[model samples]
Target: MDKIKVIITDLDGTLLNKEHQISDYSKKIFKELYDRNYLIIVATGRHHLDAMPLVAGFDFPIYLVTSNGARIHNPNKELLFSFDIESDAIKSVLDLEIDPEFTTVLFKEDVWQTNKTNEKLNKFQKELNYRPEVVNFKNETDLKAIKMFFTHESHGKLIELRDKILVNHDHLFSHAFSLPYCLEFMDKSVDKSVAISKILEIENVRFDNAVSFGDGYNDEKMLTATAHGYIMGNAPESLKKKLPQLQIIDTNEFDGVAKFLAASFLDADVLKN
Candidate 1:
């Protein structure tokens, strides 16, 4: 295989391991890939703020495509591009009939919001290390929200909500759970494929020269769009069943993305196969 000029990767279950941390081997390989002038792009369902920790203190000036494709940020956290949601739409979203099994989170700029929070929401707060402003359904607050998240114990219910949201709001973007317990949202155009295509245009790279990795329903369009897309072996059965044609790589626990990088761009023998 010839050199892939850019490598785009999803965060939660593709680049990040079971522990939700980038392994040392992966980080080392990333450095090597960057050193060789390969542009490493963080393409994920996460927001720009959620992406910062994984990239902090890294030597290279990596680019971030977050909120699906609603936001594009450089290593320095500069907003190279962004998309917004109207305040009324955000409020209307809160008014939707939310399943008690699912907790809805409102992302107003950088802060998160919830109505009558529960333990699950509290857990996420602890994980994120930030407390969101709690409000009753009656309270009115002026906040510029860009995204919303929903978490549910039932995968089926989550799927139902995802589909219903998209059906009801043609203008809104509704994505499947990036993890087993969540659903994320932004503008309908805010997907990794669209974001990466935009980035490719800005960077003057061809779609055929780009590669990407992902393991969820949200990643389907992105994988199909890229010239070379690797689906992690640990990807959900639904994804694997849908994308049998793409190459399947090992799990992130094994530094799967990096291993592919080393073989495809670094090792000569494997390149021949």
Candidate 2:
């Protein structure tokens, strides 16, 4: 096998443990890899600021693929590439005659905005330590949205909204479920794999030299695009079934990523013990 030059992993369900924190064990392993000159890249559905707390301990610089690949930031947090959702597309989603129970959040270049906050929003804020600005959507215009997220307790309702959007606006957007209750929308051309591809090109690394780890629907393309793709055991069986060729590791709660890395690139004894 070729040496892994680039390491890309998702945050929420791949690198983070059940408590939504990166374990010290994982941090140590990642730091060692960073010290060894491996390029560490975090690709997630999270905004860059929201993803920071989980990765704050690493002293080394890392690339960030945020908003499910709507934006990519360099090690210095400078924007490398971005694909903002069209203003018309944003307006179209805002105009959709959907149930009021569903909560919508719009991500711009720097901040996330929403018109309403609910229990789900509060829970998310508590986990990430970041909150969105509640703004009046009716008066909002000329907004450059990077991604739009919708969440509701009813999975069926979210699916209904997704199908409705796809029916008329499919040409303008790509949609996926980050969680069962969460639906995310991005530009038609945006995805983690696309962003990773661009980053790989910029770093002069081959796709075969990159190893990606992910578990959500948005991660499917990213995992597939790399030569070594790993799906977490906690991933939905449906996702595992879809990509049977990829290896399955332990769940995030068990520090699966760290274990795999130690076994694959570092000391095999880390897993033996």
Candidate 3:
């Protein structure tokens, strides 16, 4: 019930519905929050280029913390902050034997590159889009990788890989499960909470004045850093069980974030659809 000066949320499973699209009801709720002068921030493991389109139509400023906190962009889409995995670290991972079945995607400044194409990923996106350039990492020399995404059908396999990487290469990068099928890797120092804190500082705000929502292992820090944080009902059981202290809200399929905003901040009820 504390006053909230900023609202931060993850993309794939928090603000976005099950289909990875924003619902009209949520749009209405966000618009009202903007009208009421509530600050908004979108924190995701997505690249800045990929995230830009999803939040663009808001018609209000929404700061972005992308690449699992490796990059930050202002509402105007100006690059405010950025960090990259050291090229040596990039080469080290690229050298490690990864499962051939995994689809590997790389991110840099305005560059989204992948080793292969997987149409199956479309189901998890707002668009059935193949937006990354297919490339062979072995031949690349000059590269700035902010984050690496590895996807597989088995979330459990990805979890195994995450553990393996952390155990063998813990000093090289941080790892997380951004989605059931997606494993994310970034510089060891990258963190969504740290990124959000930077934004809060720029705005002259404090953690206690912000509320955040997320549904991934990558979100743990940001959720704990904020004064109020909630996890979606649809979030993986592991995450829910791991962070029982945070409240669990309705699933994204049911407009969970919007419903919460309506109850906590708006006068009108969000009638169930």
Report RMSD for candidate 2. 1.9
> Per-residue CA lDDT of candidate 2, range 1-273, in tens?
456899999988789887777888888899888988899999999887778766777777899998999889898878898888888878877887667678888887667888787665565443545667788787897757889989999889898899888888889898888877789999999999899898888999977998999989999999998879999999988889999999999999998998888878876654542
State the lDDT of candidate 1 residue by residue for 105-170, as single tens digits.
Answer: 776666667765667545422147345777664476664466777887887888788777776676
**How close to the true structure is residue 114 of candidate 2, measured as C-alpha lDDT?**
81
Stretches of model 2 off by over 4 angstroms after superposition: 125-130, 269-273
Regions of candidate 3 where Cα sits further than 4 Å from its true position: 123-130, 269-273
lDDT of 1 at 21: 73
Which pairs clash in the backbone of model 2? Answer: none
TM-score of each: 0.88, 0.93, 0.93
Task: Give the Cα lDDT of each candidate.
Answer: 0.75, 0.85, 0.84
- The full ranking of all candidates by TM-score, starting with the best, is 3, 2, 1
Q: Residue 96 of candidate 1: its Cα lDDT?
A: 72
Clashes of 3: 0
Clashes of each: 1, 0, 0
